[model samples]
Target: MSGDARGLWVTFEGGDGSGKTTQAELLRAWCEDEGHRVVRTREPGGTDVGQTIRELVLHHRGDIGPRAEALLFAADRSHHVAALVAPALARGEVVIQDRYLDSSVAYQGAARSLGAEEVRELSLWATGGALPDVTVLLDLDPVAARARLDADDKPFDRLEAEKSDFHARVRDAYLALADADPERFLVLDATASAEDLAARIRERVAPLL
Candidate 1:
């Protein structure tokens, strides 16, 4: 990548209702306020085609096998990386992806029994090895996360409605990723107040800027 390529790539990751989205938005707004160019996007739906795939992957109640779901997510990532994510990064925009390859590795690999290495290989291939420079994982208890989701009135999607055990495994995978790459992954507790959490994110990201 060129020295002047789009801004640093940061990704938010965690189990559902772990405040990744909330923190991502806060970070994006803060960056914009600081006069930094920022691009906020998400995997499986950063582009039109990817959005279609996202609908199928998240909202659809159909029973898709583990491998099938993995492939579909990969397909969405391919399009998202090529058409949306990569281009933004190339332009030197700070790209904030809501969820990226880590989500796939944790959900499909750890939770669904696909194997983490296999998921990593697929993600590298799909995104052309476009790993995020900084990954912030909002660590939260699985039960707490599900309770937060349940409190919302929106209909739970297929993945959202998964059992607590599955989410616990997913959380473990996230922790493993952070442990495996301490230099790149920043694991933060999710039980903190939103403002405090956002302040932590700002502190962690400010030095990178």
Candidate 2:
């Protein structure tokens, strides 16, 4: 691992059921295997405070306005960074995170028709401009992703239950974000085998370690 006092931070992002969690776990395990301290977490629920917010944002059966939804996610992120993310990094542990700031940018800003830049700016401000060293984006077809989610026999969360059109917009927004920051993102096709995707991600991360 690099000798920097702060640990390397990596984020996994994608649309619903696009395998962000799977990829994040793989990276976490790999970092552990390599003898680096690994701290694994996910946005919207990375901290105890974030858990309450996560339930409200993702499962509450009510209409949340676009602006309100965006702010809720940002609020969770702010708490997450202060309570979990920043401390882990300061300890020099590799922080593997699922669904970071880009998620709010894609889901709320793009999919919900709020301005993408404004939402991103809100997140940046919340985190004091903290960005992952690498962002792995799993690009999957919305239909196929939905099918994968269905096979799990788990009820979809509010975002997952959204119409395919909304998911498509979220997908496009993620791709755009990756394209705009090619140096910081590794965009991968989600249809690839999980093993293959994990290997590719590990390969990309090896240099940093």
Candidate 3:
């Protein structure tokens, strides 16, 4: 948002099975159809370097200390913001990213017992205080989220495999973030139908466009 480009940065935040990707894709397609260039990306794997970092942090077999894991995510975030996210916006494209600093704040800071404020500060420092124009939080119960994941038949990543309590804490942290910044966040219930959710997201994004 702070970047000096005539573009918009929209990010999605939620639990593992919260349908963030689906909604983001929907928005991207709608934007493209409206003649707006759109880039759909995700944290931890938004770039080639980020993909490697994602494997180490989310798919590695061995146990990684909590601090090390947090630092790894921060590292990937730093590179992603500089390499992919910033340039996309600079080109006047609509960047609908799946996650941003909020994920690190929720997963590492709140769920992992690292302070959210500190984690946020770490990311801000890394990115020179870059922030999204708008962030959409798809709210859902972690239990429901887990059930949706179970239905996918795909392997759970490291964080997705965590206990329900961990995810619950993550959700709480996400809601708290939205509550703290109502003007910057558009909170939506993930329980709604995908089409319905997509419509609501479009409604919120229309103004920015």
Candidate 4:
């Protein structure tokens, strides 16, 4: 995706409570320290339209059908890339995003049994095949991840409140994605120290910068 673009796009992916937000913030700060302009954002809530979709897809009280959920996420992704990510890259600003197509592939696709390749293709079409220069996958055990969330004492969102098996499927799907595209993915152990993970992420991203 960065082949013709002047800027780099880096996306973070993982299950809920995998410390994706924390690592994304660390990378954002490091990029600023290195004198790079950074555009930090997240999927489903990256824009006004996305924020509404995020609420519907993630926090709504009732159930959303699998295909409907996938389409909602795709809608958010389409607008997010067009209105935010693409513009930032055009201006030569590093875009650090939390989650992306990978989340949709893992959650709505694998966990929801909607088929990974199908979900991926939908996202690709939605974003006009836009992809990140680098993707960081923070792999973590679902049990451990759940423990982290429980410790936080926050109410679980719709996806986060799913059964353990569902989350396990999401993790497996993520690992498969990393394995399939090792070049674009930096798979890190979410169990590692935050500082250690940050350093490893920087090492992977420095060359791209």
Query: Which has the greatest lDDT?
Result: 4
Clashing pairs in 4: none
Q: Give the count of colliding residue pairs in each prediction.
A: 6, 0, 0, 0
Candidate 3 per-residue C-alpha lDDT over 1-209 given as tens digits, one digit per residue, 9 for 90 to 100:
45476789999999999999899989999999999999888888999999999999989999999889989988998999999888888898899998999999999999999999999999999888889989999999998999999999999989999999999999999999999999889999999999999999899888878
- Please list the C-alpha lDDT of all candidates, in the order they appear: 0.88, 0.90, 0.92, 0.96
Off by over 4 Å in 2: 1-5
Q: Write the per-residue lDDT of candidate 4 for residues 2-57, one digit (tens) a residue.
A: 58799999999999999999999999999999999999999989999999999999
| Best first by TM-score, ranked | 4, 3, 2, 1
Which 10 consecutive positions of candidate 2 have the poorest summed lDDT? 1-10
Q: TM-scores for all candidates?
A: 0.96, 0.96, 0.97, 0.99
**Clashing residue pairs for model 3:** none
lDDT of 4: 0.96
* lDDT value, residue 95 of candidate 4: 98
Deviating ranges (above 4 Å) for candidate 1 = 1-6
Clashes of 2: 0
Evaluated at residue 6, the lDDT of candidate 1 is 52
For model 3, the superposed segments whose C-alpha errors exceed 4 Å read none
